[model samples]
Target: MRRIRIKLNRIPSLPERRRVGRKIMADLGIKLQMGWNPFTENIAPKAYALMFETLDKFLAVKTKDNRPDTVRGYTSYVKLFKKWLLEHGFDETSYVCSFTESDAIDFMDDRDLAVSARTFNNSILFFRVLFNWMIERKYIKDNPFMAVKRKPKRLTQKIRRLFTPEEFNELIIWLEANNVPYLVMALMCYCCFIRPKELSMLRCRDIDLDNQLIRISASIAKNEKDYTRTIPDSMMKYVRKLDLSNPGHYLFGDHPMYDFSPGTKKASSRRFASYWSYVVRPALGFPKELQFYSLKDTGITNMVNSGVPLTSVQQQADHSSLAITSIYIGKTDRASEALKAVDIID
Candidate 1:
């Protein structure tokens, strides 16, 4: 028998190689389905049709658990990631299971370069939750995002400054004079230590003016924990005077001044921010770093300075820990005065 020798020329092109590899893999998969265990091969892992499918399921579960804000955040982050993946040559058919730690790291690094530290850290956290969900459901063997770390935020003594009594009065006067619908919200935040979003989402029935208490429902609370806040005397009369013909109506529903339609629709965080940017900020003479959130800090800080125990102030603010409440206190003259009262030589 004569043995024929074959001569090898140039190797196949990259695309040709890929096509050949895919054909081989497909044949292997078909054979495995037929129970032909060649070389005792491991079964191929199932992959999602698209990244969005996994995201949709994750969001559904989060929503069912009453974590709307978390759902919104995760959705936004995943959408951004999807867009980034597409821009970088990934397509809808790409398996989410194929995503690697390097991919997550690259995404985080790119985002960190383009955004603030807080935003960058938020993206990291979002991906951590996302991949953990994938792993829990056996969609992936491991979380690729586990390797990513959050960027530490710089500690600022005054992250947001507490409003002085004069500044608070000026704000109230401006809101009243301009007929801004957020006047009630501002007062609620300043006096009752209610978060803007919680106050905005309050219903007529949420308030018990007779008892001088406002109940923040778990659905609207930031921490998803319901708590009652005592309504300050200054805001009691105002709360009682609100039109409660519809018990289900939003306490701070739409207003013509704020360009919102009057209805049961809850006031959005965006609308509140817009109101601050265009109206409140300018009206307050553009006070340095002053924001609507300052109302909560101002209220809590005032309580602390007015001889209210830190524990009491923490409870009123609904803070999970005293450490969180301390951040709002900043450096008050009252604290200095109290410290000055210590006579070492007396």
Candidate 2:
């Protein structure tokens, strides 16, 4: 029998201390015989896994359970931290409790983590999550990243304005003339209001031309939930041009340039951005603020301006609430024209 005697002073206000004890006791399945001894006869200290061993265990739990993209992201963060750990001469056999708040701060301040505010913030969040997982399993007493501050994160890329009709038409003409591979993909981003990542995961089978609905799979979806997006009436003629007869084939994927054939393999989600950055942006002399994602904004604006119901817009965008749809709706293009009728300062 293992006996633990702790006179925890001011435990009423020290909820963290109480929480730690509760977590460890619950995780080890130790029903306290004495009501004070958290470590029951079941738990063996010798059987406890080391730091590296725990990492392997964490990965084992995630590899089969989590999404591939999620797993990859977590793995990359681990690799970076592992590299930092190795550089600082951290022993792989050290217990999770060996890591301190200062150590976490140093890791956060590491030059490699200075990529962007979002990346740095995400790294902190990842560590917080990892340490919390460790704490739950009785590997650590506290989360080190809890002391590490997150930098202000603004998604600069996503803060986009709507595209003008003139620029939009010009780009389409250029795309058609140049026989660009991203032609269909670019149109889908606007017409279907699909994000690049979502479009990259699209298969011919996912699209129902008969019903004019496109199914967003749970695996590749941003929200990790299944969604159905409508193909607007105007887009039907354009969508029908594609050979979506091959149910197994990718709608916009690895295929010959200008061929517009169903591809056997999935294409990179970054292709749209790549083309916009190198080809389209340069040729059109578009400003830095005019990103490729602006099409989704522009399209949504047009849909609302054309008298599409707000509820329908909310559903089509796959937003959780109508408020999010309203945020994107912003000041519509026709708002200026409509405001002209109302004379101010009468």
Candidate 3:
């Protein structure tokens, strides 16, 4: 028998002790079903903390290094998950520990039925990573999303597109003639082949017109590797237009009254989404399908077609391989096509 100690309001008589033992025995079956060892564990009361608190703790540690946009995505996903848990009664004291792959699928099916393949895959990644972390620290016994299948991108609701010359010219004209502050950002995306996330982490110090280079340090780069993007001489006229006096300020941010402003801090890539929705999308009358990133596509396509070396475009794109760059080149719009054409964003 195992030695155990119990504290009570008063010394219990033998009859009272036996009565309490019976109650404990009855609860043990339920505890076992919940993945808790009632005899050896008493952690549910403090650890679960009514579910949401526990989830918040996980997020605090897990998303600390994620980009602002990614953090927001994770937070929103968690909120929806928590609401689902409350509705489905998964918020019980030890229900989190009891979660299995079946429950994970149920949540995905119920919440992600109509989401895009990218969104569905990202959600699966989030849950798998979240649960793996939990399992590592003994918070749970298994990863609930370990076996979930990814939705095929081809089958998902994707709005694939390429910018026609007419559309591209119209957009540039609109930017030059209005207060589209993201014009410079769009130019960087198109000209220098930089991603919005990378641009968000950029400071004035990174843009060196004198050297015709933009530096991406490993800390800020998505690939965790240092990269240098050349500032084409043709684009220098536009690059020179930026206010680089304050080397510490973010390159594409610092709108004085903007909600997504990263003033004195790193801005979020999410600002691009809001800017596109509230500003550019309405002004240009562009559909949701024509993403700002499509500018990068136009640039890559223009370069490869204009006889720029495959390896050269690959390096400029910071792509891991030529294969990926080739894929971008494969989806070109000749009418809206190259270097002379892109001449554009972040």
Worst ten in a row by lDDT for model 3: 42-51
In model 2, the runs with Cα more than 4 Å from the true position are 1-49, 111-113, 153-159, 224-226, 256-260, 332-335, 344-346
lDDT (Cα, tens digit) per residue for candidate 1, span 1-346: 4332211122246774465456546855896799985445322243332465567777778778756666677678768888998887676545564577888888888897898777777677778877787777766767777888766557214456767778888887887666545677777788778876676688888878778888888888888788998887877655555666677888777655684322587777678878888877886796757888888777777787677788988888788899987775645644476567888895
Cα lDDT for residue 324, candidate 3: 90
Local accuracy by lDDT, each model = 0.71, 0.72, 0.72
Candidate 3 residues lying further than 4 Å off, grouped into runs, are: 1-26, 29-76, 100-102, 134-142, 146-148, 256-267, 333-346
| TM-scores of the models, in the order given | 0.78, 0.78, 0.74
Whose TM-score is higher: candidate 2's or candidate 3's? 2
lDDT of 2 by residue, 195-256 (tens): 88888778999989889899998888889899898887867766777778789888776654
TM-score of 3: 0.74
| lDDT for residue 64 in candidate 3, whole number 0-100 | 79
CA lDDT for candidate 2: 0.72
Worst 10 residues of 2 by lDDT: 40-49
